[model samples]
Target: MMRRLLWFSLLVGLLLVVMPAAAQTTSTTAQVPEAVEITVGDEVEGALTEAAPSAEYALQGAGGMLINISLISEDFDSYLSVRDDAGTIVAFNDDSNGERNSRIVGLAVPEGAVYTIVAESYGQYIGSAAQTGDYTLSVSEAQVLRIEYTQTVEGELTSDAFSLDYIFTGSSGDTVVINEGSDDFDSYLRLLDASGAELFSNDDSGGSLDSQIGPFVLPSTGSYTIRAGSLSGEATGNFTLSLNRIESQAIAYGDSVEVEFTNNAREHYFTFTGAYGDIVTITADSSRTVDTDLTLNDPYNSQVMFDEDGGSGFDPEIDSASLFADGTFTVILRAVDSANGTVVVTLDRVPPQSLDEGSQIAGFSSSRTQIPMLFTGVAGEKVRLTLTSPSGNTSSSLNLDVRQDGTSIAYANANTLSAITVEFTVPNDGDVNLLISEYSYTNFQFEVTLERVG
Candidate 1:
């Protein structure tokens, strides 16, 4: 006889073509009887024996109604099948929702179509060794729970329904965050049509045993489904499911936006329009409690830069970077390696000032550490760049970085030098940044002079 042990693979929802011409329910004699009439919320008790091994019931419901059928049996490994009025099986199962018993879900037969529910032991239904037992078959309407925005719902991961399902509606560009947390089980979360772009996930990608999916942007306007269950199939317990909507705001050239992260969400996103050939800087700062990570993606969804701990301690900053494309760019803010908290992100556009031959621009290193400038030079032409601190000439530290097409052609830092002066042959002509930083925390002002006397 075919015996379904729980540890064995619990295959469900497979068509059975070899069902015996059998009978059912407290009888040894085989009978060709009509299908019993039933409806939702009906439970019928029957027996499956070698001679009388199967029984059928006809269901009447409104058209387009979704329903679930279950065959539970302690005395036998149950099998189930549902057929429409046209005699085409709509659904069948050997194990339903990770159990030895059977269940058919989302069975939406045509309106006015009759659905026949068949129940039998696995072995007898497939024409194998004879088996007999009592069973309880149930039919109910399909239920899809909804996790509302900012609402936390308590749920249980039970064997009968290993995966709890919820749905929400979203528009084309809406970003969403979902969290599934549990102290008893390692939670697992999945989106039904999950081929869309995702900004971040938590638990598995967030932190610790909590499970989260999204920071996912909906690609269209419709109902989206979220399935929550245990990461490990063996776990079962109480869990919480939450949904949060992320509102993206436009960022200007030089403004700071502060956002927070909870255990439910670990990442946030912002967008900005940048012009081609623009030089910009971005910084993310938070208290010591938060470790920030930042990612910049161009309009084509390609990553322009990523930074972690490139700012002050536990913060992230992208310094003096060039933007080659003119379009809307995305900035991703994330918390890494620690509990989530508030983070302030700022974008600064550094307009290039002319540094022509024998010209000098007085600049200061205050909150902004780098000053961008444009200097045109021939491929083989050499030039000398000089820096002087007004607090005292050559008294403060400085650096000069020249770049072409985002690649560095020449770089110079004061290190142990008393003066910051660099001379190099121009490599393919572009722009550079003359930077003065608080070396040893000594605040100072400085000027950079470009000379063609190389």
Candidate 2:
């Protein structure tokens, strides 16, 4: 047992994450069979020596109770290890919140039982003669945070204790949205049932590297746990946690709703009723300077279709999309890349633009605002697509992308009315897309012509 304690003490610096605490300490020069008697809230002074290298104190508590243990010393770096009746280490700490003093917060005992608290110098057992020190050991009940729906709270995560849990109660059929935002660290969040089963988890849905879960509908009426933490275990900082109960907004066909993007990574959800196999045209249009994105989800919260830039000038449009199920569908609007701003999303009854031989469409283009046109092509068919700006004297540069399905097959560029001429043999017998955009941020008027060559 003495050799084991020394070996484990050597590992304190290497295993910084979570390892069973080891060691003990005593004021007496000789070792004792039973540990010194101590109780919660009582400050006991003890010293580590070569003869009596460690000491253990017994703690008795009820089931599911959480406790905080601390070992503060002026002599040397202190370490604390907690063990159950079976002598198995359950919790341990060498430092708390980046401090040298040892402390463990929110340590919960699943069942009512007695445990042993071991105290010693950081490297005392490993023969570091400088580890001899006097430490004040204390224990106290842990604090539990209770959250209410629609309420927000400020929280912090230290390097030692990087995660915190908050409890809340919700009724069945309620939709809840949880947001954990932090500028200091990337946030990660999880919701667990009373039995500690994780129902949902999220990372980076609450916009700009924040974590969000929901509009998640509650499965039953009961208390729930929200574990607020960071995306990286080493990340430590302050954060804002919010619990919001939301109602799905309703939208109808032919309705145009303007959404103001609050962040670069946001999920703005809306609902609409759809009939079986009904084709709908949905478009999310923003300023010609920004790119927009959107997704269609079925009632089950499963995505049906997504579009990033299918609309005119860097907008996302799901044109003539046939619904497979008849129910309330969800539409989530988002910003593409760094394009965060306002967008007008409309659900209209229209047909997808399909260009044929000799067909031409005139449009405007700007940097990051690309205009995409659809065309049908047969396999091995030779075709030429040309984009001319003004009277061959347009400002800014234009680029052309020939894509089969969603993958770009060819690329070309031009500066003025000097048309971007790219001729290629059709790789497949399907729909081909031509995306035209300006390389320079300036806006330019352009006309795209598609002609099949014999």
Candidate 3:
């Protein structure tokens, strides 16, 4: 039988009160026997020597319980490791608590297994000839928290600056929102990875004095931290912290989004990929009782267009032309005030197309807006224009015109249940504009065909 000697060092503190050491056990066949029983809120003091490099304790708790273990030592660097009864390593920590101390905080233990926690010195990494020292080991239970809860924290700022941290576990492609807007202080927010690297930061992004940091799509799966603080670095007061998971709909052309705006002021985002010279149009229709607003942003997050009542009545529309680049565009739908209603939004693209002589174009005239078409003609060429409204629908009527260099060449109008055609000869070789103006507002389809004639 090999006798293992246990050592001890002293640290005077409330949570660091010393306790007697447990019997040391050596693994005979890679299986350590008779671990010390350490329950929650218990602190055990022991020493490690180069001869006996590590100490083990048995952690007993229910599944889903948050187990926190810390190794605090001022004499030597501390390190920790956790393993199950099968000798399989479950978790480990080194230098995570700062100042060379070791800590494994908020580790969830599953059911049906006894966990062994080992604490020792960081041998070669510490670069010290004396590899043994005393450490105060503490095992405590923490409250398990959900991700979507709103917490109100009242704190004052110190010279070191005041900030609060909340842990969140997320997978790839998940969008998380952190909001700290329900207070009077100017708020700031930052999203960080496990290593404390900033992924995204924002100050005053939630509008006014509030702060918001997402709809941020996580790029990887792991533990992330959201930090909330004051933008002034010294402001203090009561504030509300809200952490939540949000779902955004994938949207593009020909798709409509059903939206409702509560009194809390909500905004919805949509994405569209476009190219230079492409004209993208977004229209919103709301109930007569609700007034809506629309905003389009380029890939660079620059505002492309914003409309409060550009559409007929209180509806909103955005017609963007000559996009500067090719990438995904973002559309934000909002309400003019606190209102709840359904809004049907549509995305329309008008890419550049050639319309030479004898070319025809078809489109819908239900928007009660002007539709413009471009065509080319040679000098001394005679072109024919036609506008045919939907027959059997008496509500359909439209006016058409041909123009060059802001000068009109020919014009025609069709009343309800009628059609119009006009012919004209071109004086120069260039592009001609065909304009369609709505004579009456109704749901109908109209077509225009062009032909060259002597």
Error of 3 at 147 (Å): 7.4
lDDT order of candidates, best first? 2, 1, 3
lDDT for model 1 comes to 0.70
Candidate closer to the true structure by lDDT (higher is better), 1 or 2: 2
Range of the 10 consecutive residues with the lowest summed lDDT in candidate 3: 1-10
- Candidate 2, which segments miss by more than 4 Å at Cα? 1-33, 62-64, 121-130, 155-165, 171-176, 184-209, 213-221, 227-238, 245-454
TM-score of each: 0.46, 0.46, 0.41
Tell me how far the alpha carbon of residue 2 in candidate 3 is from the true structure, in angstroms, after superposition: 50
| Residue 93 accuracy (lDDT) in model 1 | 83
lDDT by residue for model 1 over 1-454, one digit each (tens)? Answer: 3476532434432213222333223555665357888788888888876666788888876355656788898988888998777798767888754557887754555566777888888887787874678889888776768877788899887766766667777788877768788888777776754222122433453345776555567777776667777765436899888888887768989899988889876777888999766878899878677887887767655556667777898788887665767888878788886587788889998766678655565444333445566677676778888776655645445666667666677787776454577788776645544433434434455567788775
Task: Choose the strongest candidate by lDDT.
Answer: 2
Question: Using alpha carbons, what is the TM-score of model 2?
Answer: 0.46
- Residue 273 lDDT, candidate 2, scale 0-100: 92
